[model samples]
Target: MTRMRADLLLLLAAFIWGTAFIAQKYANDSMGPLSFVGARFLLSWIALAPLALYERGKAGCASLGKSDLGLAALIGFCLFAGAGLQQIGLVTTTATNGGFLTALYVILVPLIVWAITGARPRRIVLLAGVVSIFGAWLLAENGHLQKWTSGDALILIADIAWAAAISLVPIFLARCDRPYFLAFAQYGVVAFLGLVGGLGLESFSGEGLAAALPAILYAGLFSGGIAYTLQIVAQKYTPAAEAALIMSLESVFAALSGALLLSERLTPLALLGCGLILAGAILVEAEPALRSARMVVRRRRR
Candidate 1:
């Protein structure tokens, strides 16, 4: 797929995830976070199994070495950490706060990539990252000076896990070009971990399961099965830096979704935060063309 198409996929995934905050928050009302996460990703793993098998069959390759398993396991741990904490955070935080706070990974991704590879991103990418984080802060705080809650703190930690998971994707994908399998593998790991954690820490009931069924289906099928699969495939084509910015739009989408669906109204300051987030996304989008034009001008002078 072209980078443009890959970016569009990320954009769509952002929308799905943005709306999914509502489902996630709703699920928290009926079940413990661990139980909800277990059910969600377990369902998603099942949904993706057929597609993963089809990809393996079409490629005529299903050879996963020990290294592949190792990488997938590491990614799974990061994903499990990230997804589990974010779900737990949604229980206490507003969907808007959860959405924007979760976007902290957009800033962390570059730093993690730099730390891992020692390759600096473009100046504009750095600038976009700074702008996006500021916007996130504003959106999350809504121009108020308030102490951070446990939920907010949880999502912040989840951002670190998200950045680690995202940075590792390129490394794994370079060695193994199977997006579906990787996604499936991580989902399986998360499902297993979540289920195990839930069983040990929280009690489950048939009524809770029934109460959260709609949310489980929405979070599992659309957010996990469809959106996350799109993320893995899109990241194969899109650069990680650009992909982070594109996906960061999920914050804006989450705010809007919260407003429309949950009647979470935003103040004027919050509106400015949303606008700034879009500005950052637009700047990230324009950076490549801007650089190419500058190089063209320099060539003409030469």
Candidate 2:
């Protein structure tokens, strides 16, 4: 597929993921957080089985070494932990707060990369981080940090975990070529871990299972399967900085979907937070545009 097509697919994938927060909320109502996550991952794993087989047939899955498996498992665990924590946080947090807090991962990614590899972010990224921090404060506390709730705090923690996961992806992907297989393995590990946690804490019920199945299926197929695959493809062609900017649209889409579908109202402060997040995203992605502009200027000067 062309780069343009891949980029468009990634944006659509972000929209699907943004709206998935609502579906996750609904599913959580019927099942425990871990249980709901387990169910969704189970379905996702099943759906990915065929794709994994196809990828493996061409590349030989056995070629993946011990280190690759270990890295994949770690990524899967991080994914599960982040999702599971976010689900727990949502039980007490407003959807708006959850959406805004989750987007903090974008800011955290650069910081995490800097810490891990000693690579400094560009000026725009630093500026965006400052803006995103301000936005997060507004969204979580309306500018009053003392007003923050436990749920909001939990979501913030999940945001950190997600940032780590995002930073780790480049490292893992560098070691492996089969994105589909890696994706499948990641979800499969999460499914297993989620089920173990769910069974340990809560008993499963048929009625609850039936009630949450639709939401779980939607999250698994669209959010987990297609959206994740698109992200992988898009990341391959798009620079990480640009991809992060596009993915930041998740917050905007989530807010709009929640307003339209759930009848959720955004407070003025929350809207301001959203705007700040958009500004931050633009700042984070500014390097590419600046470079392009500089190239054009040089050609014109010639």
Candidate 3:
């Protein structure tokens, strides 16, 4: 695909993922968090099976070892936690809040890397983190950091889990060289855990599941299969930095979709907070490009 077409595909993917927040919230109206997670991922597993299987015979696909499987399982658990908590949070939080909060994961990943590896993050990364926190504080009810609602707190915690999952997936893929299969395994792990959690902690009813079917299918099939496929394909042609910047628009789309479709309105302060958080994420993804351009300018001057 042409670069422009690839970027548009990515934009479409972001739109789909952003709007799926509505479906997730709707699912919670009838089903519990874990139940919805289980049902959603179960469908995701099925929808993705063919693609994952196709990758199984690809050249880079490697036989997984016990340690690799263990790592994949851990990543799956992290994903499960992230997705489940986000769903639970959506039950009480507006989709706009959930989307902005979830976007914090991009900034959080650098902090997570620093924590694990003791490598100092660039000043830009630190600034981005601070900006995101300030934005989150603004985004909170009453514009106070301490005044975060329970749902907001859950969404923040989910971002931590998402950061962990994001950081570890590269390691897993490096070792296994099976991106789709790892995804397959991770989805299965999430599905299994969600099912177990739903059975143990939440009441399950067929009527509830039936009521949630549209949400489940939209979140699982469209968000999972179509959007994900678009992302994978688009990334092949787009620069990584450009891809990251574009994908970050997912939060913006989420907020707009929530406001337009769900009648969720944010205060001016909250909107400012969303802008700061988005700016922080954009900075995180754009810094390398900025630095590169600066270096080129310096060389030209010399």
Candidate 4:
């Protein structure tokens, strides 16, 4: 694909994922969070199964090795935890809040790396973390600590889980070359765990399932499968830095969708908080490029 086409594809993917936050919220109107997660991931797995088989056939592998399987399982567990918490958070919080708060995961990544490796984050990363956290407090508190809801707490935990999951990706990818099979394994594990959680914690009704079917299919097929496929293809053409910038627009789309489609409104303070969060995330993404540009300018002066 040309760079233009790839960029468009990524933009589309971001739109899909952004709208998916609303789909998740709508799904919660009828069924439990775990059930929604279970059904959607199972559907996503089924949709991707054919592609996984095709890729494996090309590689001439009948099954993944045990190490790959174990790694996928661990990654899947992290995915499940993050997704489950986000879904539950959507139950009480507006899609707007969920979107912006979840974006905090970008800020959390460096902090997570620091915690895991005992390496100190740079000044920019630390500043971003402080800014993002203050933004979150503003968004979640809405003027009073008493107004803070369970959903805010759940989403915060989900953000941490997402950060950890993303940090694990490089390690996992280094160990396993088959991205498609690894995705299949991850989805399968998430489906299995979600199903178990749903069965143990929530009751399923056919009527409720029917009501949630559209949301589930949209999230699973379009958001999970198609958007992810587009991202994989687009990343081949686009630079990682540019792609990250484009994908970060997902938060903006989510907030817009929430406002336009769901009539969700944020107070002025909350809007300011959202803006700060977006600024912090953008700084995190742009800092490396800025530093590199500065170094080149210094060399030119010399």
Q: Which candidate number maximizes TM-score?
A: 1
lDDT, candidate 2, 4-83, per-residue tens: 67668768987998889789988878888888888888888889899888988984455788998898888788889888
What's model 3's lDDT at 199?
88
- TM per candidate comes to 0.93, 0.87, 0.80, 0.77
Q: Would you list the clashing residue pairs of candidate 4?
A: none
What is each predicted model's overall lDDT from 0 to 1? 0.86, 0.77, 0.74, 0.73
Best by lDDT: 1
lDDT tens digits, residue span 116-152, model 4: 6676667776676667556655654352444447897
Backbone clash total, candidate 4: 0
- In candidate 3, clashing pairs total 0
Q: Which candidate would rank higher by TM-score, 2 or 4?
A: 2
Model 4, CA-based lDDT = 0.73
Query: Clash totals for all models, in order?
Result: 0, 0, 0, 0
As for lDDT, the candidate ahead, 3 or 4, is 3
**TM-score, prediction 1:** 0.93
Runs in model 4 lying further than 4 Å from the true structure: 1-14, 59-64, 92-104, 117-119, 135-146, 149-152, 227-250, 266-271, 294-302
What TM-score does model 3 achieve against the real structure?
0.80
TM-score of 4: 0.77
